[model samples]
Target chain A: METIAKQGARVQLQLNGRVREGFAEPRTQLCDFLRHELGATGVHVGCEHGVCGACTVQVDGKSVRSCLMLAVQAQDSRVDTVESLAEGELMSDLQLAFRRNHALQCGFCTAGILMSCAEFLGREPDPTESQVRDMLSGHLCRCTGYTGIVRAVLEVANERKSKNGEK
Target chain B: MKPASFDYVRPTRKAEVLELLSEYGQDARIIAGGQSLMAVLNMRMTQPKLLIDINRVEELHFIEERKNCLAVGAGVPQVELLSWPRISETVPLLALAMPWIGHFQTRNRGTVCGSVAHADPSAELPLCLKTLGGEVVLESRSGSRTVTAEAFFQGILTTDRRPDELLTEVRFPLCKPGTEYRFNEVAMRHGDFAIVSLAAVIGAGTIRLGIGGVADRPVTRDFEPGQDLSAALNETAWSLDAQDDVQATAAYRRQLVRDLGRRLIEEGH
Candidate 1:
């Protein structure tokens, strides 16, 4: 009876295109909620601390650390995760460029990097190398040497610009 | 690591927050932004019986332009502060230091008052506040009291903040004419905590410098606008007794003070 009473405040989250709800402690971590509770294991948790930036996810159009946020804080909010970058195995241009450029090695840090880069480069077509570096500074990869990662982003930028008749 | 289970408390009213803090006293620990506090709990460094979730307290999250200064509420996310163009233009140093506090991920979740309450020596906001001569307003069951930056800090990782008191907001002074400012920090990476961070402000024919991560607490140096660089270093370090730790040696930071102080003074000129 007490256990039944404990589950209060069902938060409405728009994950991908579907609406989902979860009743959790106000302190339940968003990452844990996404993984253990919701079975969306695509969102990897590399560092529980904020340093690694691995658990990044889109919280209402803003990239945020799922590890650092509470599930309840995102009540009645929309969320997008790595799994949403593709739909039924179709990938976005940035995702394909990452593949074509051999950007990822271990693949653990890819999703967060992809989400952040997708948002950043979508708004910026002709970003400088330093701007790319600065924007990507937060996401860390222990596998790739960062050369392929940066190059892959440049590849996407050139391809996207050429396709759009941009300089 | 999973945090030890504890009773959760979310108080909506300021008076309710004050009362909860008083009722729990030392056994109660506040969470805002949870940047540092969450890490503390995860590490088992602190296990407060009552976890006061101040993030739900609506009054704590604000960025209002007060009569004499900018009143930044405790719950104002660090990212929101950076995104505010007016804050960037009006409080340039604070703007400059925000990105350096943590990566975008951390800043998105970190809070202004959480930075002050944790009072890490290397943290950016403390030095920014110290350099700007900001004031912190503390609220408790009794009433409110303001502590100037210089007097607010007590020692390393410590403040004059009482156990029962909650820091409600931080007040940053309005910039004056000719107020050129510079914030510089060196880390292994750009966003990592600084080995030594300096916030230098020049205005009103005076020079104000705040040094962090070089001492037990932030140390400030005030000089006549045109004072010589070497003299400023000697007075600020030797007279003030800057402390050092594992990140970099004490002597190295002292030398950095001289080098950075010289550069900032010239830049401010």
Candidate 2:
């Protein structure tokens, strides 16, 4: 517990299928580190206290609030930011559904919501509207009223289910 | 808001964590999952000189069935515990209440022990522990000691844990036969902190009720099935000393205790 001098520590993590390296002070949050140091701006930072859910990202395949985690804690882990959701200009089905359903307006909360939906849909491929609404509870959108987001998520789920040939 | 400057250390072994705790006592804070602690840090509510990250301590990540209780370690995340294969059969009350703890994003990284250690009055895990008479294990360099949930939670955002002691695990007693449980809460939104939460355990001859978010700490009482149930619930509600806050009025909370208490009791029956 001896206090050391304040300084930046080296942090390396697999971000968006790439090994990214950066330096973070002990007090640096994962969101700030990803955006400021590692240049992953897709991980937004609305509330640094974990309530706004604008900083959601995947660490080891689980969606978490980047604001609530230290960058040093994510070392050696696999992280997925919203930048990884698409394949070189091609939007993922969920993103396309959001566009088709007009799910986003301000676009400030879109990245985090998409990250959360990606993880949720990966686990539950055929979620009901209520389930999707429950998942959206984690996120706060000043725009859209969450109706289109819910519709978009359910639409993607239905599309994925039929493509997988599951009833 | 950014956290104040501090030295961070990830201890790979439980012993290392214990040693750090022993050395720093009140100056060192253990960071497991960092769900609650991070928020406080960002707000500068606490400025510990050093943060001992225990996520790398592999020995502390486990959920074991020990005789009459389920022991959850400090490193076991809430999501993992919620998804445990035998959780519903082993601890049905927890199974019924886990989803109400937080949102899916937070639960993926928040630890069960972390929430108990944080000792938020409205949190589901602490209320569950108190209602089930669970035990909390506090470990330090010198030794380890176990405290019952009732004795562990001292007040709002407080606990009986010493500065040098680390909350290593919490043991929830296994559900007994012929006993039924029902948990419900009223919150502004799903995943928000409960305005008033209630847990009821109905046994063969007794009904135990635990109430949270209406007091400084979660409170519990036992009532005989043959007694005046409404009167007893009213007395218990009055004894909680509810206060007026932004989320709810003191009178409204008391009313919830009287009404929700009755409904939960009936549901259990």
Candidate 3:
């Protein structure tokens, strides 16, 4: 028999548009729950420690270290992972540019960089290269040298600005 | 990296929080944001019998501007504090140090109280709080009392915080106009822990300098206007006790401390 964390208070959480309800341990890490329980491997865990930024996810439109968050803390929160950035058939312009620039090599830190950039660009349409570097300074990408990575974000920022006319 | 299994409590009432802390005493570990504590627990460093989750206490999440100081709640996220313009405008040193606390992701999860409560010798907030002459409010079943920065930090990860008391809020005193403050840290990587960090607050009457990562706690030196800090560090007995660790040799850190002290005095003024 599984010991119950909450009996009557059913866990009601929204994960990328789908309603998820379950009785997970209050100490259950959201990163493990997303990948093992929900089968969404897009949110990869590199350091288990919260430094690598590989397991970042958006909780209420803010990027958070998923490894440090408990499942119960994420309850009732509007969670968005890399899986939510792309629709069924097509990916966002950021993703497309990341592919075009060969921004990722091992592809472990890509999901998080993509997620952070996607959200960051939404707030800052035309981010300078230094700004992108400042925001991306936390993420560790051993393979990509970040040459193409920074370029990919700049390309998307410029594209969005050109199309939207600097709004 | 699985943490030790432990009981948890989420107290909504302040009275309930104080009662639990008093009852549990050493067995209970209060978690504000769980950013640093969780990391330590994962590393098998600390295994408390119970975790008192204080993040849900809504009352401890405000940034109130007092008449003489700013009262920042312990449970307030660092990211939330960053968005508050008053915090940035009033205490520009903290605004400068806030960006280097960790990263955008970690900042979202880390709490100001948690960071200060942990009281790591290398952490950013502790140095800033110490330099700015901040005070922390401690609550227990009995009552509440405030501890000054100079007397608050006891040793490495140790504080005057009683076994039954919990840190609720931090008060950073207001500096007069034209107070030139500068904070700097030399970390291995951009987001990695600083090898040696320095925070200097210069005012019209005096100049206070804080150094972290070189000692077990934030070390401060007082220099009245027109005093030579370069000659002062060598004379201060406390500077002689700077310790070395795996990050950097003691000799190297001491050298940096002396050099940085001079540089901070020169540049900060």
Predicted model with the maximum DockQ? 2
Cα lDDT computed for each candidate against the true fold: 0.80, 0.92, 0.81
When only the first chain is scored, the TM-scores of the models are 0.90, 0.95, 0.91
DockQ of 3: 0.41
Off by over 4 Å in 2: A1-5
CA-only RMSD, every prediction: 3.0, 1.4, 2.7
Ranking by lDDT: 2, 3, 1
Residue A115 shift from truth in candidate 3, angstroms: 1.8
The deviation in Å at residue B72 for candidate 2 is 0.5
lDDT per residue for candidate 1 within B1-269, as digits (tens), equals 55566666566767788888888888988887887877677667887777777776788889988778888998898988888879866788887778788776677778888898889988999888888989999999999999998898888779989989999999888777678888887777888778878888877777788888788778788888556768767667665465556666777777778887777778642
Candidate 3 or 2, higher DockQ:
2
TM-score of 2: 0.98
Q: Residue B196 in candidate 3 has what lDDT?
A: 78
Instruction: Please give, for residues B1-269, the per-residue lDDT of candidate 2 as tens digits.
Output: 99999888888889889888889999988899888999999999999999999888999999999899999999999999999999999999999999998799999999999999999999999999999999999998889999999999999999999998989999999999999988999999999999999888898998899899989999899999889888989999899999998999999999999999998997552
Off by over 4 Å in 1: A1-12, A23-27, A122-126, A158-165, B238-244
Error of 3 at A30 (Å): 1.2
Q: Which candidate is the best by lDDT?
A: 2
DockQ of each: 0.35, 0.64, 0.41
For model 3, the stretches where C-alpha displacement exceeds 4 angstroms are A1-10, B235-240
Following a full C-alpha superposition, what root-mean-square deviation does model 2 have from the true structure?
A: 1.4
